[model samples]
Target: MSFIPRRPPRHLLRLLVLLAVAALLYFYSAPVFNAAARSLIRVDAPAPADVVIALGGDARCMRERRAAEIFNRGLARHVIVSGVPYAWGVHTGDAAKRYVESLGVPAERITVLRDAWNTRREAMDVNELMRAQGWNRAILVTSPFHSRRAHYTFRRYAAEYTFISMPLEPEPPEWQPERWWSRRGDLGITVREYLSWINTLAGGWR
Candidate 1:
Protein backbone atom coordinates (compact mmCIF):
# COMPACT_ATOMS: atom_id res chain seq x y z
CA MET A 1 0.00 0.00 0.00
CA SER A 2 1.13 3.53 -0.59
CA PHE A 3 2.41 5.26 2.53
CA ILE A 4 -0.70 6.83 4.05
CA PRO A 5 -0.46 9.23 6.96
CA ARG A 6 -2.61 8.26 9.94
CA ARG A 7 -5.94 10.21 10.00
CA PRO A 8 -6.52 12.71 12.82
CA PRO A 9 -7.48 10.82 15.97
CA ARG A 10 -11.19 10.29 16.58
CA HIS A 11 -10.63 10.95 20.30
CA LEU A 12 -10.81 14.71 19.65
CA LEU A 13 -14.09 14.24 17.81
CA ARG A 14 -15.46 12.16 20.67
CA LEU A 15 -14.40 14.80 23.17
CA LEU A 16 -16.16 17.49 21.16
CA VAL A 17 -19.33 15.45 21.07
CA LEU A 18 -19.16 14.84 24.81
CA LEU A 19 -18.70 18.55 25.51
CA ALA A 20 -21.61 19.41 23.25
CA VAL A 21 -23.91 17.01 25.06
CA ALA A 22 -22.82 18.32 28.46
CA ALA A 23 -23.48 21.87 27.35
CA LEU A 24 -26.93 20.96 26.11
CA LEU A 25 -27.76 19.04 29.25
CA TYR A 26 -26.76 22.01 31.35
CA PHE A 27 -28.26 24.75 29.20
CA TYR A 28 -31.67 23.23 28.52
CA SER A 29 -32.24 21.10 31.58
CA ALA A 30 -30.62 23.30 34.20
CA PRO A 31 -32.86 26.34 34.00
CA VAL A 32 -35.98 24.29 33.51
CA PHE A 33 -35.00 22.09 36.39
CA ASN A 34 -34.22 24.93 38.78
CA ALA A 35 -37.15 27.07 37.70
CA ALA A 36 -39.57 24.22 38.08
CA ALA A 37 -38.07 23.41 41.48
CA ARG A 38 -38.42 26.98 42.68
CA SER A 39 -41.92 27.07 41.33
CA LEU A 40 -42.61 24.03 43.46
CA ILE A 41 -40.89 25.57 46.45
CA ARG A 42 -42.86 28.76 46.22
CA VAL A 43 -46.23 27.30 45.39
CA ASP A 44 -48.52 27.07 48.39
CA ALA A 45 -51.66 26.97 46.31
CA PRO A 46 -51.03 27.44 42.64
CA ALA A 47 -54.41 25.93 41.92
CA PRO A 48 -57.13 23.57 43.04
CA ALA A 49 -56.75 19.84 43.43
CA ASP A 50 -59.04 16.95 44.31
CA VAL A 51 -57.47 15.14 47.28
CA VAL A 52 -54.51 16.55 49.17
CA ILE A 53 -52.58 13.30 49.48
CA ALA A 54 -50.09 14.11 52.20
CA LEU A 55 -46.46 13.04 51.72
CA GLY A 56 -46.03 12.35 55.41
CA GLY A 57 -44.26 14.09 58.34
CA ASP A 58 -44.72 17.83 58.76
CA ALA A 59 -46.21 18.11 55.33
CA ARG A 60 -49.08 16.06 56.62
CA CYS A 61 -49.13 17.28 60.20
CA MET A 62 -49.14 20.97 59.40
CA ARG A 63 -49.37 22.59 55.97
CA GLU A 64 -50.99 19.62 54.33
CA ARG A 65 -53.37 19.67 57.24
CA ARG A 66 -54.63 22.98 55.93
CA ALA A 67 -55.27 21.48 52.55
CA ALA A 68 -56.94 18.53 54.22
CA GLU A 69 -59.16 21.00 55.97
CA ILE A 70 -60.55 21.90 52.62
CA PHE A 71 -60.88 18.27 51.74
CA ASN A 72 -62.77 17.68 54.96
CA ARG A 73 -65.15 20.45 53.99
CA GLY A 74 -66.28 18.27 51.13
CA LEU A 75 -63.81 19.27 48.45
CA ALA A 76 -63.06 15.60 47.86
CA ARG A 77 -64.30 12.37 49.27
CA HIS A 78 -61.09 10.39 48.96
CA VAL A 79 -57.58 10.94 50.30
CA ILE A 80 -54.75 8.47 49.96
CA VAL A 81 -51.85 8.45 52.40
CA SER A 82 -49.01 6.08 51.45
CA GLY A 83 -47.60 4.28 54.48
CA VAL A 84 -48.03 0.97 56.20
CA PRO A 85 -49.10 1.34 59.79
CA TYR A 86 -49.23 -2.37 60.28
CA ALA A 87 -45.80 -2.98 58.78
CA TRP A 88 -43.32 -0.19 59.52
CA GLY A 89 -45.56 0.98 62.35
CA VAL A 90 -45.45 4.64 63.56
CA HIS A 91 -42.26 5.80 61.99
CA THR A 92 -43.65 5.97 58.46
CA GLY A 93 -47.39 5.74 58.16
CA ASP A 94 -48.88 5.26 61.59
CA ALA A 95 -49.09 8.92 62.53
CA ALA A 96 -50.32 10.01 59.11
CA LYS A 97 -52.71 7.12 58.90
CA ARG A 98 -54.21 8.10 62.20
CA TYR A 99 -54.22 11.77 61.30
CA VAL A 100 -56.21 11.22 58.13
CA GLU A 101 -58.62 8.89 59.83
CA SER A 102 -59.09 11.50 62.53
CA LEU A 103 -59.98 13.96 59.76
CA GLY A 104 -63.22 12.09 59.30
CA VAL A 105 -62.10 9.97 56.39
CA PRO A 106 -63.89 6.73 57.05
CA ALA A 107 -61.52 3.77 56.95
CA GLU A 108 -62.96 2.89 53.56
CA ARG A 109 -62.59 6.42 52.23
CA ILE A 110 -58.96 6.67 53.24
CA THR A 111 -56.49 4.40 51.50
CA VAL A 112 -53.26 3.81 53.39
CA LEU A 113 -50.25 2.41 51.54
CA ARG A 114 -47.50 1.63 54.01
CA ASP A 115 -44.41 0.59 52.11
CA ALA A 116 -42.69 3.64 50.66
CA TRP A 117 -39.16 4.19 51.92
CA ASN A 118 -38.74 7.58 50.27
CA THR A 119 -40.79 10.09 48.34
CA ARG A 120 -40.04 8.39 45.04
CA ARG A 121 -40.96 5.07 46.52
CA GLU A 122 -44.03 6.63 48.03
CA ALA A 123 -44.93 8.11 44.67
CA MET A 124 -44.60 4.78 42.96
CA ASP A 125 -46.57 3.01 45.66
CA VAL A 126 -49.33 5.59 45.50
CA ASN A 127 -49.34 5.39 41.71
CA GLU A 128 -49.87 1.65 41.79
CA LEU A 129 -52.45 1.95 44.52
CA MET A 130 -54.40 4.61 42.67
CA ARG A 131 -54.50 2.52 39.54
CA ALA A 132 -55.61 -0.50 41.49
CA GLN A 133 -58.32 1.47 43.19
CA GLY A 134 -59.19 3.24 39.93
CA TRP A 135 -58.48 6.62 41.50
CA ASN A 136 -57.72 8.82 38.53
CA ARG A 137 -57.71 12.29 40.12
CA ALA A 138 -55.76 13.59 43.10
CA ILE A 139 -53.93 16.49 44.67
CA LEU A 140 -50.53 15.64 46.14
CA VAL A 141 -49.61 17.05 49.56
CA THR A 142 -46.02 17.94 50.30
CA SER A 143 -44.19 20.99 51.64
CA PRO A 144 -44.64 24.16 49.63
CA PHE A 145 -41.20 23.79 48.08
CA HIS A 146 -41.31 20.01 47.94
CA SER A 147 -44.69 19.92 46.26
CA ARG A 148 -43.14 20.52 42.86
CA ARG A 149 -40.84 17.54 42.92
CA ALA A 150 -43.38 15.30 44.56
CA HIS A 151 -46.08 16.40 42.15
CA TYR A 152 -43.82 16.08 39.16
CA THR A 153 -42.50 12.66 40.13
CA PHE A 154 -45.94 11.34 40.99
CA ARG A 155 -47.34 12.64 37.75
CA ARG A 156 -44.47 11.25 35.74
CA TYR A 157 -44.55 7.77 37.24
CA ALA A 158 -48.31 7.47 37.40
CA ALA A 159 -48.71 8.84 33.86
CA GLU A 160 -52.47 8.45 33.79
CA TYR A 161 -53.41 10.04 37.12
CA THR A 162 -55.09 13.43 36.79
CA PHE A 163 -53.64 15.75 39.42
CA ILE A 164 -53.91 19.22 40.82
CA SER A 165 -51.19 20.84 42.90
CA MET A 166 -51.73 21.88 46.55
CA PRO A 167 -48.61 22.68 48.49
CA LEU A 168 -48.23 23.09 52.24
CA GLU A 169 -47.54 26.70 52.98
CA PRO A 170 -44.16 27.13 54.57
CA GLU A 171 -44.26 28.05 58.22
CA PRO A 172 -44.45 31.63 59.43
CA PRO A 173 -41.51 34.06 59.50
CA GLU A 174 -40.04 32.11 62.41
CA TRP A 175 -39.22 29.11 60.24
CA GLN A 176 -39.05 30.90 56.90
CA PRO A 177 -35.73 31.03 55.14
CA GLU A 178 -33.80 34.29 55.24
CA ARG A 179 -34.48 34.87 51.54
CA TRP A 180 -37.47 34.28 49.29
CA TRP A 181 -35.19 32.47 46.89
CA SER A 182 -34.14 29.92 49.47
CA ARG A 183 -34.76 26.31 48.39
CA ARG A 184 -37.18 24.11 50.28
CA GLY A 185 -36.38 21.53 52.95
CA ASP A 186 -36.40 20.36 56.54
CA LEU A 187 -32.80 19.39 57.15
CA GLY A 188 -32.11 17.95 53.64
CA ILE A 189 -35.49 18.17 52.03
CA THR A 190 -34.68 21.26 49.97
CA VAL A 191 -31.49 19.82 48.57
CA ARG A 192 -33.16 16.51 47.89
CA GLU A 193 -35.99 18.22 46.04
CA TYR A 194 -33.59 20.36 44.04
CA LEU A 195 -31.78 17.27 42.83
CA SER A 196 -34.99 15.46 42.05
CA TRP A 197 -36.28 18.36 39.95
CA ILE A 198 -33.04 18.34 38.04
CA ASN A 199 -33.23 14.61 37.43
CA THR A 200 -36.79 14.81 36.09
CA LEU A 201 -36.14 17.70 33.68
CA ALA A 202 -33.14 15.89 32.25
CA GLY A 203 -35.14 12.68 31.90
CA GLY A 204 -32.05 10.85 33.16
CA TRP A 205 -33.65 9.26 36.16
CA ARG A 206 -34.19 5.50 36.61
Candidate 2:
Protein backbone atom coordinates (compact mmCIF):
# COMPACT_ATOMS: atom_id res chain seq x y z
CA MET A 1 0.00 0.00 0.00
CA SER A 2 1.23 3.55 -0.91
CA PHE A 3 0.03 6.97 0.33
CA ILE A 4 -0.49 9.74 -2.27
CA PRO A 5 -1.18 13.52 -1.86
CA ARG A 6 -4.10 15.03 -3.81
CA ARG A 7 -3.69 18.44 -5.61
CA PRO A 8 -6.29 21.19 -5.06
CA PRO A 9 -8.66 21.86 -7.95
CA ARG A 10 -7.91 24.90 -10.14
CA HIS A 11 -11.47 26.21 -9.78
CA LEU A 12 -11.18 26.25 -6.02
CA LEU A 13 -7.99 28.25 -6.19
CA ARG A 14 -9.60 30.72 -8.61
CA LEU A 15 -12.60 31.12 -6.32
CA LEU A 16 -10.41 31.77 -3.32
CA VAL A 17 -8.46 34.46 -5.19
CA LEU A 18 -11.68 36.14 -6.31
CA LEU A 19 -12.97 36.13 -2.74
CA ALA A 20 -9.79 37.68 -1.50
CA VAL A 21 -10.06 40.45 -4.06
CA ALA A 22 -13.68 41.05 -3.18
CA ALA A 23 -12.91 41.23 0.51
CA LEU A 24 -10.11 43.67 -0.12
CA LEU A 25 -12.32 45.86 -2.27
CA TYR A 26 -15.07 45.85 0.32
CA PHE A 27 -12.74 46.70 3.13
CA TYR A 28 -11.21 49.63 1.29
CA SER A 29 -14.30 51.04 -0.41
CA ALA A 30 -17.11 50.40 2.05
CA PRO A 31 -15.84 52.75 4.71
CA VAL A 32 -15.35 55.61 2.24
CA PHE A 33 -18.79 55.15 0.75
CA ASN A 34 -20.44 54.89 4.13
CA ALA A 35 -18.60 57.96 5.33
CA ALA A 36 -19.79 59.96 2.37
CA ALA A 37 -23.36 58.86 2.93
CA ARG A 38 -23.24 59.58 6.64
CA SER A 39 -21.66 62.94 6.06
CA LEU A 40 -24.47 63.90 3.70
CA ILE A 41 -27.14 63.11 6.27
CA ARG A 42 -27.69 65.33 9.30
CA VAL A 43 -30.44 64.01 11.58
CA ASP A 44 -30.19 66.13 14.67
CA ALA A 45 -32.36 69.22 14.87
CA PRO A 46 -31.97 69.64 18.58
CA ALA A 47 -32.69 73.33 18.80
CA PRO A 48 -35.19 75.85 17.46
CA ALA A 49 -34.64 78.32 14.66
CA ASP A 50 -36.16 81.37 13.00
CA VAL A 51 -37.75 79.41 10.14
CA VAL A 52 -38.07 76.04 8.47
CA ILE A 53 -36.77 75.90 4.90
CA ALA A 54 -37.91 73.08 2.64
CA LEU A 55 -35.54 72.93 -0.33
CA GLY A 56 -36.79 72.48 -3.86
CA GLY A 57 -36.46 69.69 -6.55
CA ASP A 58 -37.96 66.87 -4.48
CA ALA A 59 -41.44 66.28 -5.88
CA ARG A 60 -42.08 63.59 -3.25
CA CYS A 61 -42.64 66.34 -0.65
CA MET A 62 -40.64 64.41 1.92
CA ARG A 63 -38.72 67.47 2.99
CA GLU A 64 -41.88 69.55 2.98
CA ARG A 65 -43.51 67.13 5.36
CA ARG A 66 -40.46 67.23 7.61
CA ALA A 67 -40.57 71.00 7.57
CA ALA A 68 -44.21 70.87 8.53
CA GLU A 69 -43.39 68.57 11.41
CA ILE A 70 -40.69 70.94 12.60
CA PHE A 71 -43.10 73.83 12.33
CA ASN A 72 -45.74 71.90 14.25
CA ARG A 73 -43.19 71.25 16.94
CA GLY A 74 -42.69 75.02 17.25
CA LEU A 75 -39.09 74.76 16.16
CA ALA A 76 -39.54 77.71 13.88
CA ARG A 77 -41.94 80.60 13.57
CA HIS A 78 -42.13 80.40 9.78
CA VAL A 79 -41.69 77.95 6.91
CA ILE A 80 -40.12 78.93 3.62
CA VAL A 81 -40.90 76.61 0.75
CA SER A 82 -38.22 77.20 -1.87
CA GLY A 83 -38.24 75.84 -5.40
CA VAL A 84 -39.02 76.64 -9.01
CA PRO A 85 -41.69 75.28 -11.32
CA TYR A 86 -41.81 71.56 -11.93
CA ALA A 87 -41.96 69.85 -15.31
CA TRP A 88 -45.72 70.38 -15.51
CA GLY A 89 -45.32 74.08 -14.80
CA VAL A 90 -46.56 73.81 -11.23
CA HIS A 91 -44.67 76.03 -8.84
CA THR A 92 -43.01 73.58 -6.42
CA GLY A 93 -42.54 76.18 -3.74
CA ASP A 94 -46.19 77.15 -3.81
CA ALA A 95 -47.23 73.52 -3.96
CA ALA A 96 -45.08 72.68 -0.94
CA LYS A 97 -46.36 75.72 0.91
CA ARG A 98 -49.92 74.69 0.18
CA TYR A 99 -49.25 71.20 1.44
CA VAL A 100 -47.69 72.53 4.64
CA GLU A 101 -50.58 74.94 5.06
CA SER A 102 -53.02 72.07 4.73
CA LEU A 103 -51.08 70.35 7.50
CA GLY A 104 -52.15 73.17 9.90
CA VAL A 105 -49.33 75.61 9.35
CA PRO A 106 -50.69 79.12 9.07
CA ALA A 107 -50.61 80.76 5.65
CA GLU A 108 -49.05 83.87 7.11
CA ARG A 109 -46.29 81.83 8.62
CA ILE A 110 -45.38 80.29 5.27
CA THR A 111 -43.46 82.00 2.48
CA VAL A 112 -43.17 80.53 -0.99
CA LEU A 113 -40.17 81.43 -3.14
CA ARG A 114 -40.69 80.09 -6.65
CA ASP A 115 -37.71 81.86 -8.19
CA ALA A 116 -35.05 79.48 -6.93
CA TRP A 117 -34.41 77.24 -9.90
CA ASN A 118 -31.45 75.53 -8.23
CA THR A 119 -29.88 74.98 -4.83
CA ARG A 120 -27.39 77.83 -5.12
CA ARG A 121 -30.13 80.25 -6.14
CA GLU A 122 -32.36 78.95 -3.39
CA ALA A 123 -29.64 79.56 -0.86
CA MET A 124 -29.19 83.09 -2.17
CA ASP A 125 -32.90 83.77 -2.09
CA VAL A 126 -33.27 82.37 1.42
CA ASN A 127 -30.20 84.24 2.57
CA GLU A 128 -31.59 87.54 1.35
CA LEU A 129 -34.94 86.82 2.91
CA MET A 130 -33.26 85.94 6.20
CA ARG A 131 -31.36 89.20 6.14
CA ALA A 132 -34.47 91.21 5.32
CA GLN A 133 -36.51 89.53 8.03
CA GLY A 134 -33.65 89.69 10.55
CA TRP A 135 -33.69 85.92 10.99
CA ASN A 136 -30.67 84.60 12.82
CA ARG A 137 -31.09 80.91 12.05
CA ALA A 138 -33.01 78.46 9.86
CA ILE A 139 -33.97 74.81 10.07
CA LEU A 140 -33.14 73.53 6.60
CA VAL A 141 -34.95 70.41 5.46
CA THR A 142 -33.92 68.32 2.45
CA SER A 143 -33.32 64.76 1.25
CA PRO A 144 -30.66 62.75 3.06
CA PHE A 145 -28.44 62.57 -0.02
CA HIS A 146 -28.81 66.26 -0.76
CA SER A 147 -28.52 67.69 2.74
CA ARG A 148 -24.73 67.98 2.84
CA ARG A 149 -24.49 69.75 -0.49
CA ALA A 150 -27.45 71.89 0.42
CA HIS A 151 -25.76 72.85 3.66
CA TYR A 152 -22.55 73.73 1.85
CA THR A 153 -24.39 75.77 -0.75
CA PHE A 154 -26.49 77.61 1.81
CA ARG A 155 -23.50 78.31 3.98
CA ARG A 156 -21.57 79.63 1.02
CA TYR A 157 -24.29 82.13 0.28
CA ALA A 158 -25.59 82.82 3.77
CA ALA A 159 -22.69 82.76 6.15
CA GLU A 160 -24.24 85.29 8.50
CA TYR A 161 -26.98 83.06 9.87
CA THR A 162 -26.96 79.57 11.31
CA PHE A 163 -28.35 76.69 9.22
CA ILE A 164 -29.37 73.54 11.02
CA SER A 165 -29.69 70.94 8.30
CA MET A 166 -32.25 68.19 8.84
CA PRO A 167 -32.17 65.34 6.33
CA LEU A 168 -35.10 63.06 5.59
CA GLU A 169 -34.51 59.36 5.99
CA PRO A 170 -33.72 57.40 2.86
CA GLU A 171 -36.93 55.85 1.58
CA PRO A 172 -37.09 52.53 -0.20
CA PRO A 173 -37.74 52.15 -3.98
CA GLU A 174 -35.68 55.30 -4.37
CA TRP A 175 -32.86 54.63 -1.91
CA GLN A 176 -31.60 51.90 0.40
CA PRO A 177 -29.28 53.24 3.04
CA GLU A 178 -28.48 49.90 4.61
CA ARG A 179 -27.61 48.27 1.29
CA TRP A 180 -26.80 51.23 -0.87
CA TRP A 181 -24.58 49.29 -3.25
CA SER A 182 -27.22 46.72 -4.15
CA ARG A 183 -28.87 48.91 -6.81
CA ARG A 184 -27.57 50.81 -9.79
CA GLY A 185 -29.88 53.71 -9.00
CA ASP A 186 -28.42 54.08 -5.52
CA LEU A 187 -24.89 54.00 -6.92
CA GLY A 188 -25.75 56.71 -9.40
CA ILE A 189 -27.28 58.81 -6.64
CA THR A 190 -24.27 58.37 -4.38
CA VAL A 191 -21.84 59.27 -7.16
CA ARG A 192 -23.87 62.27 -8.26
CA GLU A 193 -24.12 63.59 -4.71
CA TYR A 194 -20.40 63.25 -4.12
CA LEU A 195 -19.60 64.96 -7.41
CA SER A 196 -22.02 67.74 -6.60
CA TRP A 197 -20.33 68.24 -3.26
CA ILE A 198 -16.98 68.38 -4.95
CA ASN A 199 -18.27 70.85 -7.49
CA THR A 200 -19.67 73.03 -4.73
CA LEU A 201 -16.27 73.03 -3.07
CA ALA A 202 -14.68 73.96 -6.41
CA GLY A 203 -16.70 77.18 -6.52
CA GLY A 204 -19.46 75.88 -8.73
CA TRP A 205 -21.88 77.33 -6.18
CA ARG A 206 -20.80 80.79 -7.25
Candidate 3:
Protein backbone atom coordinates (compact mmCIF):
# COMPACT_ATOMS: atom_id res chain seq x y z
CA MET A 1 0.00 0.00 0.00
CA SER A 2 1.26 3.47 -0.90
CA PHE A 3 0.66 6.43 1.51
CA ILE A 4 0.06 9.97 0.22
CA PRO A 5 1.99 12.87 1.85
CA ARG A 6 0.12 16.08 2.65
CA ARG A 7 1.64 19.61 2.36
CA PRO A 8 2.07 21.75 5.45
CA PRO A 9 -0.74 24.22 6.15
CA ARG A 10 -0.39 27.69 4.55
CA HIS A 11 -0.98 29.37 7.93
CA LEU A 12 1.90 27.43 9.44
CA LEU A 13 4.21 28.49 6.63
CA ARG A 14 3.17 32.14 7.10
CA LEU A 15 3.77 31.89 10.85
CA LEU A 16 7.21 30.46 10.26
CA VAL A 17 8.11 33.27 7.90
CA LEU A 18 6.87 35.85 10.41
CA LEU A 19 8.95 34.27 13.16
CA ALA A 20 12.02 34.38 10.96
CA VAL A 21 11.43 38.05 10.19
CA ALA A 22 10.87 38.83 13.84
CA ALA A 23 14.08 37.12 14.80
CA LEU A 24 16.00 39.04 12.18
CA LEU A 25 14.54 42.30 13.40
CA TYR A 26 15.17 41.46 17.02
CA PHE A 27 18.81 40.83 16.26
CA TYR A 28 19.43 43.78 13.94
CA SER A 29 17.18 46.60 15.11
CA ALA A 30 19.80 48.52 17.08
CA PRO A 31 21.07 50.61 14.21
CA VAL A 32 17.49 51.32 13.09
CA PHE A 33 16.43 52.62 16.49
CA ASN A 34 19.71 54.43 16.96
CA ALA A 35 19.07 56.35 13.79
CA ALA A 36 15.52 57.05 14.97
CA ALA A 37 16.87 58.44 18.21
CA ARG A 38 19.36 60.55 16.32
CA SER A 39 16.64 62.06 14.19
CA LEU A 40 15.73 64.35 17.08
CA ILE A 41 18.98 66.24 16.71
CA ARG A 42 18.99 69.16 14.26
CA VAL A 43 22.15 71.23 14.09
CA ASP A 44 22.29 74.14 11.74
CA ALA A 45 25.47 75.70 10.47
CA PRO A 46 26.84 78.47 12.68
CA ALA A 47 26.17 81.87 11.21
CA PRO A 48 26.77 85.38 12.43
CA ALA A 49 23.70 86.45 14.37
CA ASP A 50 22.78 89.39 16.51
CA VAL A 51 22.68 87.18 19.57
CA VAL A 52 22.97 83.62 20.76
CA ILE A 53 20.26 82.43 23.13
CA ALA A 54 20.92 79.46 25.37
CA LEU A 55 17.76 77.81 26.59
CA GLY A 56 17.59 76.73 30.23
CA GLY A 57 17.60 73.37 32.09
CA ASP A 58 21.21 72.58 31.50
CA ALA A 59 22.63 71.42 34.78
CA ARG A 60 25.84 70.44 33.02
CA CYS A 61 26.20 73.94 31.61
CA MET A 62 26.79 72.55 28.15
CA ARG A 63 24.36 74.99 26.59
CA GLU A 64 26.07 77.90 28.31
CA ARG A 65 29.42 76.67 27.16
CA ARG A 66 28.22 76.54 23.58
CA ALA A 67 26.80 80.03 23.84
CA ALA A 68 30.11 81.30 25.10
CA GLU A 69 31.94 79.53 22.28
CA ILE A 70 29.65 81.09 19.72
CA PHE A 71 30.14 84.50 21.25
CA ASN A 72 33.88 84.06 21.45
CA ARG A 73 33.91 83.05 17.80
CA GLY A 74 32.07 86.28 16.93
CA LEU A 75 29.14 84.35 15.54
CA ALA A 76 26.91 86.29 17.90
CA ARG A 77 27.42 89.65 19.50
CA HIS A 78 25.42 88.90 22.65
CA VAL A 79 24.41 85.89 24.73
CA ILE A 80 20.97 85.58 26.26
CA VAL A 81 20.32 83.03 28.95
CA SER A 82 16.65 82.11 29.29
CA GLY A 83 15.27 79.92 32.06
CA VAL A 84 13.10 79.78 35.15
CA PRO A 85 14.04 79.12 38.76
CA TYR A 86 15.80 75.89 39.54
CA ALA A 87 14.83 73.40 42.26
CA TRP A 88 16.68 75.46 44.84
CA GLY A 89 15.03 78.71 43.70
CA VAL A 90 18.15 79.99 41.96
CA HIS A 91 17.18 81.26 38.53
CA THR A 92 18.57 79.10 35.77
CA GLY A 93 19.07 82.11 33.54
CA ASP A 94 21.25 83.66 36.21
CA ALA A 95 23.24 80.48 36.62
CA ALA A 96 23.73 80.19 32.87
CA LYS A 97 24.90 83.80 32.69
CA ARG A 98 27.53 83.15 35.34
CA TYR A 99 28.61 79.96 33.60
CA VAL A 100 29.12 81.67 30.24
CA GLU A 101 30.80 84.58 31.94
CA SER A 102 33.27 82.23 33.60
CA LEU A 103 33.91 80.75 30.18
CA GLY A 104 35.23 84.20 29.10
CA VAL A 105 32.06 85.79 27.85
CA PRO A 106 32.11 89.39 29.02
CA ALA A 107 29.52 90.45 31.56
CA GLU A 108 28.48 93.38 29.39
CA ARG A 109 27.67 90.96 26.56
CA ILE A 110 25.28 88.79 28.59
CA THR A 111 21.57 89.24 29.22
CA VAL A 112 19.49 87.00 31.44
CA LEU A 113 15.76 86.39 31.13
CA ARG A 114 14.39 84.56 34.15
CA ASP A 115 10.68 84.55 33.40
CA ALA A 116 10.53 81.65 30.96
CA TRP A 117 9.35 78.44 32.63
CA ASN A 118 9.40 76.38 29.43
CA THR A 119 10.51 76.47 25.83
CA ARG A 120 7.37 78.26 24.70
CA ARG A 121 7.75 80.92 27.33
CA GLU A 122 11.43 81.19 26.53
CA ALA A 123 10.69 81.81 22.90
CA MET A 124 8.17 84.52 23.69
CA ASP A 125 10.33 86.32 26.16
CA VAL A 126 13.47 86.01 24.06
CA ASN A 127 11.67 87.34 21.03
CA GLU A 128 10.46 90.33 22.98
CA LEU A 129 13.98 90.96 24.18
CA MET A 130 15.37 90.70 20.68
CA ARG A 131 12.73 93.05 19.35
CA ALA A 132 13.51 95.60 21.98
CA GLN A 133 17.20 95.31 21.30
CA GLY A 134 16.71 95.63 17.52
CA TRP A 135 18.20 92.22 16.95
CA ASN A 136 17.05 90.51 13.77
CA ARG A 137 18.86 87.20 13.94
CA ALA A 138 19.58 84.64 16.64
CA ILE A 139 21.53 81.46 17.22
CA LEU A 140 19.89 78.90 19.53
CA VAL A 141 22.10 76.65 21.60
CA THR A 142 20.72 73.64 23.49
CA SER A 143 21.38 70.01 24.21
CA PRO A 144 21.26 67.55 21.32
CA PHE A 145 17.85 66.08 22.19
CA HIS A 146 16.23 69.45 22.74
CA SER A 147 17.58 71.21 19.64
CA ARG A 148 14.86 70.33 17.14
CA ARG A 149 11.96 71.24 19.41
CA ALA A 150 13.67 74.36 20.66
CA HIS A 151 14.33 75.61 17.15
CA TYR A 152 10.80 74.81 16.03
CA THR A 153 9.21 76.53 19.02
CA PHE A 154 11.38 79.61 18.62
CA ARG A 155 10.69 79.92 14.92
CA ARG A 156 6.98 79.48 15.55
CA TYR A 157 6.79 82.11 18.25
CA ALA A 158 9.37 84.50 16.85
CA ALA A 159 8.80 84.54 13.11
CA GLU A 160 10.39 87.85 12.34
CA TYR A 161 13.97 86.97 13.25
CA THR A 162 16.20 84.36 11.68
CA PHE A 163 16.94 81.47 14.07
CA ILE A 164 19.74 78.95 13.75
CA SER A 165 19.76 75.68 15.68
CA MET A 166 23.06 74.39 17.00
CA PRO A 167 23.05 71.33 19.23
CA LEU A 168 26.04 70.59 21.42
CA GLU A 169 28.33 68.39 19.37
CA PRO A 170 30.23 65.44 20.78
CA GLU A 171 27.66 65.28 23.55
CA PRO A 172 28.81 64.20 26.98
CA PRO A 173 28.87 60.47 27.65
CA GLU A 174 25.71 60.63 29.74
CA TRP A 175 23.69 62.02 26.82
CA GLN A 176 25.31 60.06 23.99
CA PRO A 177 22.85 59.13 21.28
CA GLU A 178 24.82 56.23 19.78
CA ARG A 179 23.14 53.82 22.23
CA TRP A 180 20.53 55.88 23.99
CA TRP A 181 18.41 52.88 24.83
CA SER A 182 21.12 51.28 26.95
CA ARG A 183 20.76 53.85 29.72
CA ARG A 184 17.51 54.47 31.54
CA GLY A 185 17.97 58.23 31.80
CA ASP A 186 18.97 58.63 28.16
CA LEU A 187 16.06 56.46 27.06
CA GLY A 188 13.64 58.48 29.13
CA ILE A 189 15.06 61.70 27.67
CA THR A 190 14.69 60.37 24.12
CA VAL A 191 11.08 59.31 24.73
CA ARG A 192 10.24 62.58 26.46
CA GLU A 193 11.79 64.52 23.57
CA TYR A 194 9.49 62.81 21.08
CA LEU A 195 6.52 63.46 23.31
CA SER A 196 7.61 67.06 23.54
CA TRP A 197 7.73 67.17 19.77
CA ILE A 198 4.13 66.05 19.71
CA ASN A 199 3.27 68.79 22.16
CA THR A 200 5.14 71.31 20.03
CA LEU A 201 3.26 70.23 16.96
CA ALA A 202 -0.06 70.52 18.78
CA GLY A 203 0.37 74.26 19.39
CA GLY A 204 3.03 73.85 22.10
CA TRP A 205 2.85 73.91 25.91
CA ARG A 206 0.03 76.11 27.19
Give me candidate 3's TM-score against the actual structure.
Answer: 0.90
lDDT for predicted candidate 1 compared with the true structure: 0.63
TM-score on alpha carbons, each prediction:
0.64, 0.82, 0.90
In the range 22-70, model 3's lDDT, one tens digit per residue, is 9989988898888888888888887899999888887787888888988
- Give the better candidate number (2 or 3) by TM-score: 3
Candidate 3 or 2, higher lDDT: 3
- On lDDT, the leading prediction is 3
Tens-digit lDDT string for candidate 2 (32-92):
6667577777666558999999988777887888899999998999999877766686777
Q: TM-score of predicted model 1?
A: 0.64
* Candidate 3 lowest-lDDT run of ten: 167-176
What C-alpha lDDT do the candidate models reach, one value each? Answer: 0.63, 0.83, 0.86
lDDT of 2: 0.83
Off by over 4 Å in 3: 1-7, 87-89
lDDT of 1 by residue, 1-206 (tens): 79989777899889989999999986787565555445655343344444557776453366435545757777676776655444433544656767767766676776665675566777778777777776777777666766667767787788888767666556662133333335343425555656777777787645
The superposed Cα distance between candidate 2 and the true structure at residue 85, in angstroms, equals: 2.5
